[model samples]
Target: MQKKAGVGFYVFLVIFVFVIMFPFLWILLSSVKPLSELFGDQAFTWFTSNPTIQSYISVFTIRPFHLYLWNSLVVATVTTVYTVFVAAFAAYAIARLRFRGKAIILGVVLSVSMFPQIATISPIYIFLRNIGLTNSHLGLIIPYTTFALPLSIWLLVTFFRKIPFDLEESAKMDGASMMQTYFRIILPLAVPGIFTTAILVFIAAWNEFLFALVINTAEDYKTVPVGIGMFQGQYTIPWGEISAATVIVTIPLVIMVLLFQRRIVSGLTSGAVKE
Candidate 1:
């Protein structure tokens, strides 16, 4: 019975995988096709015959893809770094220490996470504008980190609780201070969780469009998503070049996820099952 169930699960997984991958496969194929073929109705039939990379070159020649790439990398990297550090410390304190209103604070974090980002956009925009952060990278960075920080803390707290407090006690007994314990023992064990959180933050910040569009007005400051959208006008969208850029953006996330698949799975499952 167990063997039969395992085979059935594998079959289901294979079908689901194909279902999810087909559209992306089609997009990738279309990206390499000529604009004429791409814009034509029978473009799907031309997928196997000829593939052209001219569309990829056109985006760079016609638009500032390099600047967009640089902006995305910088913003995502900064946001990831800030979120991981801030979230780790917050999670540690919440998980390991006893304090008044701790439950209430956690509840508030949960509530904030549940709030729709779109609903609060105007208020955030006003606040950022008032503080001279509007149209600056720091403006988006601050808010992205703030919005992502809560979920990071929540995920890390779940992982932290799985760690034995006795390890912390042992460090304390060995003449190591609280900071020492955090920096040495607890942090090493939490590396997997930290990485998972960083990837999540990077992906979220990288894909964010509304906040980036609203806060960053300059061409050089625009992230990839906004940059790509700018390619579309009222009448026409460059499907060929747009598809190529879409594929380009997806590759990094795909590689990163595959590379860290084990760590991500272990961290999430451990946190969920044990915590």
Candidate 2:
């Protein structure tokens, strides 16, 4: 009976993984297929006979896709850096220091994230326009950081709280200031968690569409998501080129996650058990 159950569980797991991975697999296959096969009878086929790299070449030559990629890299990198830095300080304070209304403050920070982007975009747009930040990378970065902070803070707070207070005490006895202890001892110990938070924040900022679309309408500042969205021509949609662009943009993120999967898992599971 147990053997049968185990076999069924494995089968279920395989199916689950396939379901999750199917869209990406489809997109990847579609990326290399020719335009004729894409819209022809092979539209729903699993594989193509005549695959071509023309779509990949066209994505760069026909449009400023490389520029869009560069824009996304810059904005996401900047947003991740700023968000993680700010969240670390804020999280460390909440985790280590005794303060009034800490729970309320954390709750408020989380509630800010719960607000729908559509609901807030109007005011945010107006504010950016007033400050002359619209159509700039900073405009997108600022809002991305704002939305990313609550989750980063929350994640970092858990990691910080799990850190041994004895370490901080020892640092204090050794003449370390609060900031010194944070930078030298606590932050180093929390590298896994910080790295995990950074990856998540970077992915969020990279794939963000609504803010990218509304804030930065210029070709120079458009990111990958915006660039992919604008792949339509006057007469027909460029599905082949869109697929190639997607494959290009997605490869980097997939590689990053695979490379750091161990650290991400470690960060998430580190403090789960009592020592």
Candidate 3:
């Protein structure tokens, strides 16, 4: 009975992983296929007999996809750095300091994130337009940081709270100022959490579409998502190039996650159990 249950669980896990990975696998296969195979009678075929790098080449040559990628990298990187920095301070205050309405403040910060992007996009667009930030990297960075903050703050707060208060007390006894303690002690100990938060924020900013689409209509400021959307020509949709672009854009994120997956898991699980 035990053996049978274990076999069933492994089978279930395999199926679950396949289901999750199927779309990416399909897209990858599609990316390598030539346009002929893509539109040919065997278009629905899972395996392409003629695999070529033409689509990948076309992704760069046909459109300014590289520029879009650069734009996304800049915006996401800036957003992640700024968001994590601000959230660290805000979270430390919430986690360590005694203050009034702390719960209410945290709740309000979270509630801001819950507001639908669609609902707020109009006002946000108007504000950015008035400030002459539309179609600029700063425009996207600002909004990305805004939406990223609540989650960053919440996660950092959990990590900060998990830290022993004795550390801070000792730092104070050693004549460390609040800033010194925060910079030297609290932030250092929360490296895993900060790394995890930064990754999440970067991914969010990278994949953001609605605001990127609406605010930055210029070719110069277009991100990967926007660039992929514009891959369609007047008469034909370049499925091959779209797939190739998807694969290209996705590789960095996959590599990032795989590289730091251990830290991510550690950060997520660190504060779960009471010390």
User: Highest TM-score, which number?
Assistant: 3
Q: Tens digit of lDDT per residue, candidate 1, span 40-77?
A: 57675746457789878977887788889988888888
Question: Could you tell me how far off, in angstroms, the CA of residue 68 lies in candidate 2 after the best superposition?
Answer: 1.2
lDDT tens digits, residues 22-42, model 3?
A: 999999999998788888687
Which pairs clash in model 3? none
User: Candidate 3, 25: how far from true, in Å?
Assistant: 1.5
| Cα error of candidate 2 at position 199, Å | 0.9
Clashes of each: 0, 0, 0
Q: Which is the better candidate, 1 or 3, if ranked by lDDT?
A: 3
**Residue 174's C-alpha lDDT in candidate 3?**
100
**Candidate 3 global CA lDDT score:** 0.87
True-structure lDDT of candidate 2: 0.87
Residue pairs in candidate 1 whose N, alpha carbon or C atoms collide under 3 angstroms: none
The TM-score of predicted model 3 comes to 0.91
- TM-score of every model versus the real structure: 0.89, 0.89, 0.91
